[model samples]
Target: MSSRFRHAALVGKYQARGIQGPLEEIAQFLVRQGLDVSLERDTALNTGITDYNALTHAEMGRECDIAIVVGGDGTMLGSARQLAQFGLPLVGINQGRLGFITDVPIGHFADALAPMIAGDYEEERRTMLEGGVWRDERLIFDGFGVNDVVVSRGPTSSMIELKVTIGDEFVGNFRADGLIVASPTGSTAYALSAGGPILHPGIAAWVMAPIAPHDLSNRPIVLPDVGRISIEVAQGRDASVNFDMQGMASLLPGDRITVARSSHQVRFLHPLGWSYYATLRRKLHWNTGV
Candidate 1:
């Protein structure tokens, strides 16, 4: 049978040692399935693989029908962010420890991917965070957050004070080590570790969790993914804000970081019958006592 995807982009964790063998194998497997394969430019350069065509993010976005990301969730996060603008669908193969989005195992990649290439899979859309730092009503820095946006203190041993506002309404003052603004997709990420509840991907919501607050009353709150949420650095030295993998450090006291749902959503292709609960159980070891 002919593959649904005419071309596939292979993105790998370029920093991983001995990644070339698996990458080459996957590329060959895709080719055998009657699909053309190309390597992401950096992956080809870093891994020293020249067999397939090397394409930039833009080139891949324009040419490839699907992207196969090989690495941990971090690698997937990077690829998703870069390719999200093109509205491309991604498939993740787990080469790292925790495979949240990268659910396909490296050992069983052939078994899991063959059918997916033939358009036999489930597609899930995940939202992202779009945010920026405003200083004196002027936009300073802006970026995208796949997991969560963090506002934290710098090299000082003091907790930063943040003024939280949800769509022009004053929430409260929080004095904490930091603050995390996570999407439903990010609920299982840093926010989960910071005591935030797990939010189902089907829900269109965001979770705001305090990081070691001075007052115990400051707790995690789930907010609807509507309107803009503003967090201002009320008081702190060298406060900073992070948009998932990217961040701006040494922010001023009056800097306000405005976060809202991004217009673009990332599409992830999963194997048939893939369940969120099953992933949570396996990754978090929730089935241990059950």
Candidate 2:
């Protein structure tokens, strides 16, 4: 069978001596296979590979048919946000400590590259959340969260109040350290640490977890990923709504944010024999009941 992807781009942690070997290996592998290959600017500079073409992040997204991300999940998260709009497919080679989204092992990935290029792989379409904040009818914060969108206190180090509504239904006024609206992809992230359930990535759902609620009775809830989630913060103190801990926007009393499933989704490619259960077992230590 012929290769499914022609132009490929390599994006990795922007450091030398760390990913240089694997980066150069994959670049040369694709080159010998006759598939066009390029590198993200920092990846090229850090790896000291002068022969292949280099593209800026934007250029890479617009140009490449596939992006082979060679870092931890953080690298993939950043890339996913940038390329999700372009609808680019990402294949990860785990160089991170915890490989949730970045699953493919380094040595194993090198071997699978050829077959993956030949269209022998599985594609996972993961859902994303799009959120925007409104201040007196003016839009302020606009961004996408792959994991969770949080509304919480800033430098004050005290609890804040948030009035929440889910699809016209009033949930409650939450008084807590913070609140996290986690996508199923986010269930394993902050939401999980906050005592929230892990919804399977394939499931279409969101989890609303309160971070240290003043009332123990206030609990996390899983809701369908439909309609809009509205959160209005109470006034008199400093607060912000954080997106993936990557972006944040200040909020005032009565300012609100509405989060909904984005129309766009991120496509992740895995080599033929990928298993989510295995990943969870390895990452979370499933069987060792200590």
Candidate 3:
């Protein structure tokens, strides 16, 4: 379905390592297009663009017809969880090293946006995972992650032993630095670093990879999105559950966390001429030497 509002919401991290310059340019360019632009309050204040409307991250999803993110994939992933269920399509401008989600570069920002504004873009639906933490039968934290939910030992702790079960079947006990339950969109992030396979974004599966496992036989495993995953800290000095690197909750010696496919999905806007493989090649320096 087409959008109903002409207004667009702008979200980004101008404070990222090397992003301020391009962010300023994009913000100014959006204003020059005669479009009604909305910005996060802090961003609006930092950039000194007072005339624009201010909205919280989630509120922006409700107010704007489309949302534009001006940072790298991490920034986009964070914003996507907040805006995904709103059914607002996201346009990401690459301002960091790996532009997986933010595929549009600074040079082509204008060209890409013009067509997008006119509704000439493709929408790709990406999966998300929802997790909940329980302690003493009390619900502690519940949230969704676009990428992965990681359960790891805290600082100064040895490797953790975690018991994993899927659909009432015992998976196995994992003895590792941590465990990563990643969506297809996240296979290239921490999971890839731990030797997990890169999953195509359109795939409807998740990967469970044990980080720095004590046993080499514990390899990464792919699971269908329909099943439920239960992970308990069978034994550990100290451990924690992290959601997309944003939210964290403490895990005592015997805490268990359950992860399942979220009913909500994130929609990404891919303007004409954008290619995911091209992004991988560029970011990874695949052909730099040749």
Candidate 4:
């Protein structure tokens, strides 16, 4: 084990069959290497491992120097919110389709494990968005979003009117499906489907993309991540702000949603040879037509 890291935490998708055997193997390997390891409670129970079991992500976070998530980006996203507070370096062992965030391949994790345990890895700091819905002049919903925050007419097939502004400047009123406020990490998600530009992870930027605008002139835009993005539900029937595709809070007419880059920065550890462009190319199949 590296001097910088003495303990590690294992987190993965709940009830995922492909991960259990690897989880058992990894836990035993870490123990043999003389490094402390904790398993996320549900994962531990699912895998039948008893050592260093943690009931909560917070417990694992406080006790571990590094966290290795063993599933897809969705699992990583869920883990990010809970474990980000502890500021530990996080990595992943991919066990899901299209593992954008979880870049490590389980087939070669054994080869990489020794170097990783020795602190031979690279880390990138990814920014998250602090989003909230303000109703009656106070925060009604608040959370950290690793990807995009969406405001829309929830469960309805009709369009809604939304007034959007960034940093005290008036943008316009958009009558459409909804608006997507995305961090750089989210540029590939819903924002991408809405014609938003792909932003490099190192870029200090965010994107404002309209889901389906009535006016085609209303285009997707990129903005500095430093300021406030305000979205007001001008005309809608029980609209809501969905954070990271996880939870939603209702928004009445005249309710405002604000999003900005959070002060909390989460670090993702990558194996030494990992490349962002390589991941994009492989996942997107950009070379297929050639």
Each prediction's number of clashing residue pairs: 0, 0, 0, 0
User: What are the clashing pairs of model 2?
Assistant: none
lDDT by residue (tens digit), candidate 4, 198-284: 999999998899988999999999888988999999998867788888666567888999998888888898888889998899999
lDDT for each of the candidates? 0.94, 0.87, 0.84, 0.85
Q: TM-score of every model?
A: 0.98, 0.93, 0.93, 0.94
67, model 3: CA deviation in Å? 0.6
TM value for model 3: 0.93
Residue 171 in candidate 1, Cα distance off native in Å: 0.9
Residue pairs of candidate 1 with colliding backbone atoms: none
lDDT value, residue 248 of candidate 2: 64
What lDDT is obtained when candidate 2 is compared to the true structure? 0.87
Instruction: Mark the 10 consecutive residues where model 4 has the least summed lDDT.
Output: 46-55
Clashing pairs in 4: none
Cand. 1 Cα-lDDT: 0.94
Deviating ranges (above 4 Å) for candidate 3: 1-5, 17-24, 288-290
lDDT winner? 1
Candidate 2 similarity to native, TM-score: 0.93
